[model samples]
Target: MKQALQLLVLIFSLTVFGQNGNTDTAQVVIPGRYNSVEAQAKPYVIMISADGFRYDYAKKYHAENLLKYSNEGTQAKAMLPSYPSITFPNHWSLITGLYPAHHGLIDNYFYDYKRKEPYAKSNKKNAEDGTWYGGLPLWGLAEKQGMLSASVMWVGSASDAGGARPTYYYPYHEKFSPEEKVNKVIDWLRLPMDRRPHFISLYFPEADANGHHFGPDSKETEEAVHKIDQAVGQLVQKVKELGLKNVNFVFVSDHGMIKADNENPLEIPQLLLDKNRFDIYNSQTLLRVYVKNPDEVKKVYKELKANKTGGYKIYLDKKFPGSLHFSTKDDRYSRIGQILLFPEAPRIFLEKGEKSTAGKHGYSPKTVPEMKATFYAWGSAFKRNITINEFENVNVYPLVAHILGLKINGPVDGKLKVLKETLK
Candidate 1:
């Protein structure tokens, strides 16, 4: 029995060290004025994503509660979302503090022509198998440090990530009532101090769903936002009720919705090409075209470059031109199609039979409103009554990693610069 126990211990250590041998220690570069220890020992951190909530919507629609939160907390001029700016990819980016390419989720849907399988947001097989997701989410980082973490409704939260999962999670399901969702978050906060999570994320999807069914400017959309705000109120009130005083709350969004264009469906006919030449899949605003041969790929690129395209702006994935700030490789979420078809000024991507009443946001991140989103933080650790200049989503991870004391393995695209000004 003693020999068996020793053997088990030996195997476990070897397995542990083997997997973490390459794990990089997180590095901290403190500013001259602030002490590292003080920054490291801050407080509880919570991030919330109100799906499809636009930067202007809150201000324009009289979302006073949210605006008050922003007014009192450290808010940004604008929160620039990542490219394609879809839900799943953007949410994944928020957690990993990585762009889609680095994180491996390019859009809500990806085509695997060889396997004849496509990855969509709700596809159970892809969600459960975990191949569709890449990188470590923020909660996973907190859990690793002996700190508890919880999430109410984050994309991929219920999915297995990096083999282990969140200490607390609730799967995304249509059957979940808004009240139930709010209560679940409140319930998690009610856990005893020893069991309380160091990090928590709450997600509300009503606004996005409503925007999709009814345009962003509609009454239905307004009602949805109000309802979500009430839920936010419930969450904030409960945190106080539970005396979770050492907490910071961040309110953000995936990407704002746009009214769908109904003029003409942006179409790419594979029938126009040699059937053996390309495999085409359309995901809303972008068309992913994968070709069989490199030579054929060149021919396609040339044709797209010289053509008087109808309503599509095309680019070769390997050499996605400047101004887009998007990586060319699809290795992470950055893997773009050989020819990406971005809808013209009045057009958006659509399948043969797809209809959308709500606007979409997969256009270039530079689109005036589409690029714009929200970021507001309030509570114990943040400086009160400060709104800083605009920053991109890439800057978000470092701030989060800093708060949670998690080390990022690679160089973060954005700096700890934003927090430098805000946290002080």
Candidate 2:
């Protein structure tokens, strides 16, 4: 058992290290950009996302620095993730103030019937393409309003979403050390007033990676949480040394983690696997079926619905639960599949012979407590020692916008009023 655990750790190390080989770590600076006079006067915000960090992780894992900092300012009981609580969707939701359906990234991997193309997070070309994303992300909003922004590695930051990427950004890569990332933020903060980024985003992948490989309750995950806690402490210390005023930090996670029923995984229904009948996009937690022949939709739905066993729920796209905001009415881009399958907590769909990860997420937070993410804010902008009830992740965009004094260009699902009370 000890040898097996060591092998898993070594594999995880190699997976992360392998991505760094020959990968460019230079900061990409878009020339000819400067903060407008109004933007220059605004306060600074550093939004940090520790992917897969659960709501209770700080307390549960004894993340001392995070608990300390949050206790000093504001900490929410929990932060609810958007429907289909996965990495790409929720990150975009947090940044754009829109639900996944509204933002056009309904899932980490999904087929767009209109575009006749697939948007997979692992596909570098499409992931970097700005056109695939919708809703003006916070970085784009800042840039549009003449505030320079920087991103160490935030989803959609590397793309030209809303016709502008962050003025300073590094395309997503796993090679850079955590210390290097912190120093880069310090460098950006140290730039000349006009050139410095007022809005900066930093991302950490350790918790999520370890959680998936070793399960949320494992010692590996606890250690990963501690690493994040230390990194946060280091960042706060370094930033304080700079004596930057009105600089606030908002920490969040895209979604939480839960152990999966890996030993008894559900296999896809045989009827749905026929190539001529359906195009299936499976994410373990959610299975989307796009029927080829429109007429066959009812027949297939009936067969699958009647034959479906335990551990999952099936819904036709039009009849999907309205609360999830993933029903047909909310699909702005018509990207959602015709039929949807959502597995209950700890249950996931896996084909025969395919291995399941020890940990999994993407369940609806409303139904599964394990899907709830994290949110904590501290620094000059937030009220001290306050705790608020759980709120939707979309509200984060408006709160950040409010901090930076950026104007909301259009209607967004997030409302500043929801989080306005947390401010000093």
Candidate 3:
């Protein structure tokens, strides 16, 4: 048994060391879609989620290393985030392979009718409770199968998502800087082999926060982009210096940013739910107005649809289009508001006497191109210098599972086949 273990370790060393520094058609041995012992011990995958990073940001900012890596490895032209493309939802989608609706993180914040509670990013209690988030996340899955995993402030990392926390994790801390997070990941990487995580998840929020405070086109956003690029450069240099073999590195974003203006905000003469005797829980981009009297559902929907104008629309939850894949038939069909509204780029939804200015996401990736995220992966298992035009972001969960040779059993919407073409 010990000899077999030693052999596995040697295979891992060869897989990583054999392909070091060979930029020309270089490849490393990976477990080829097989969940064998060799596959389990072969590679280390590090996933970095750069908040609100648009697909074009790489080229727009001339981030040399990102551009060069994507050019040399596998990159998706655009990664289509799930509907209501907000932070928590899409971030969860990337790890769970389920749409926001199924994952139950429908928006950055939403109301849960059954529990008569509201789930918001600010609420630590709800955020840490795994019950609210249905599907399994990659880190939790790793722990379940006796593999070590680490997370650095990635959304839901604090949660007992699949009934366990990562072997190593730094809970979301607002004061944490990009440099600090990167340094910590490097620390985790340098741990002894038995203590080191096979999978690591990292998050950076400067660009996303700046993109919201200053529109995506502003100098502030540009500088923030550069800062993150430098941080990534540091990560690559350190990894290469450590001579970590067969390490798979993925740099991606939850969703993209769009320039938003409050100049001609969508006007709602009536706070429909309030006017109709109801409580309201609303996110900047989506609203879930709880009707005190269920019979008024139609009345509320009608009033909202009637008062809505440019930049936004109102619809009954029941009548929401199927293409959005937000149907509640699978779960929580009743939790969302009876009425729904979505805003277009350059449009902000404000109540009768509201005001704002900032960039935003949550818009459909289908129309507002800026809302589309980015995906890039390089190392042993992925194809080199390949570019796939576009792909659904949900498939990312499966892609990670495939790279790790994990056989996940829970139901997931993302199909492995969708991402197979991009892998070796």
Candidate 4:
């Protein structure tokens, strides 16, 4: 009877194994020029993105301790963000090497063309439908390569989309403190050698938070950077303490911030405000409207196109003028608004009952220098003491893949030049 039971168990196990074997398909490997069996055997990677950090602040202040990695190792003068220069879209691009269209996260605010409901940035339930984010993030790629990854707080990281969940994830929790974020990273690093992640992102949006509250130039913003600097110090200390050698670290930000006075000088004159013509998303800077019946989107487009007072630009959904250094026209991502009103100077976009205190960024990337994010790379593989200029954030995906010895799928908007020379 015992032998019979054993035989029966064996058959059951075999049947179960065979039945579910194909259910969890193997990860599809997308080959690339950079992808090779040899490239996959390099030192591991540690990527950190601090949202809303500016390049000038690091270059000028020198307070960013980790940013020194950019100078001492391989660095870029500034990282040009995707066209809109907002948080969600640009952060998604940095990881996927694809624009908002290709990666599929069009904006921080979701627009349901069907008008199902307003897409809020922090809404997790609605975000689960898969439209909130697009493409696979770097962490997913690392996991597929048979490596481990951990994301503490990165945009589009909170969800376990496409069954592409990280080995460890600390999704956006409002109650999480900075110390909690830092400690969680240290804990993840301390996991047994086999369990610890090889890819990680450490983010602190306090600077951007302060920028929105106290303006980028204000003391509060500076203090926020100082606090984050200490956070960086703690992270490096833990890395050393945990003995995570052979790890490559890349520190970056989504975009920079602009100083705003909150006063609206370019308020649309009553004559310009056709109740039927304008759906003012931002009466000051970002203006969106559905023109009156019989009025062409282009007619309103032509009017805004000609008016350049507030540093605004008008583009039909099809035409985003200039080589804004992004694949914005791609059909995969969210196309920017029909008319984009970029602010020229210190102006804030105002809404009903909304009060602006400090700095703002949703304007044209060209108009806001702060919209330019920061980039720095160091550790086992990066070359030392070099400064390259105006590296597009899109390019980072390929560069990172090269560093980690992974391959990217799909057509990439970023190139793998300039910075390639920096790596030894």
lDDT values, one for every candidate: 0.67, 0.88, 0.74, 0.64
- Candidate 2 C-alpha lDDT tens digits along 139-225: 999999999999988988889988999999998887777778898999999989899899999999989898998999999999989
Best of the candidates, lDDT: 2
lDDT of 4 by residue, 71-145 (tens): 678878788888667777788899888776666665555444444444445455544445556677788787777
Clashes of each: 8, 0, 2, 8
Give me the runs in candidate 1 sitting further than 4 Å from their true place.
Answer: 1-42, 112-117, 269-274, 322-325, 329-335
Q: If both were scored by TM-score, which would come out higher, candidate 1 or candidate 3?
A: 3
Pairs of colliding residues, candidate 1: 100-333, 101-332, 101-333, 101-334, 104-333, 258-359, 329-335, 330-335
Candidate 1, residue 142: the lDDT equals 65
> Against the true structure, what is each candidate's TM-score?
0.84, 0.95, 0.87, 0.81
**Whole-structure CA lDDT of model 4:** 0.64
Clashing pairs in 4: 100-333, 101-332, 101-333, 215-358, 256-370, 279-289, 311-342, 312-342
Best by TM-score: 2
Query: By TM-score, highest first, what's the ranking?
Result: 2, 3, 1, 4
Model 3 pairs in collision: 16-245, 16-246
Segments in model 3 whose C-alpha atoms lie over 4 Å from true places? 1-40, 269-276, 306-308, 330-333
Candidate 2 lDDT for residue 351: 61
Lowest lDDT block of 10, candidate 3: 9-18
- The weakest ten consecutive residues by lDDT in model 2 span 5-14
Q: Candidate 3 residues 23-118, lDDT tens each?
A: 233111112122235434658899998888899998998888888888889999899998887888888999899988888888655667688666
lDDT preference between candidates 2 and 3, better one? 2
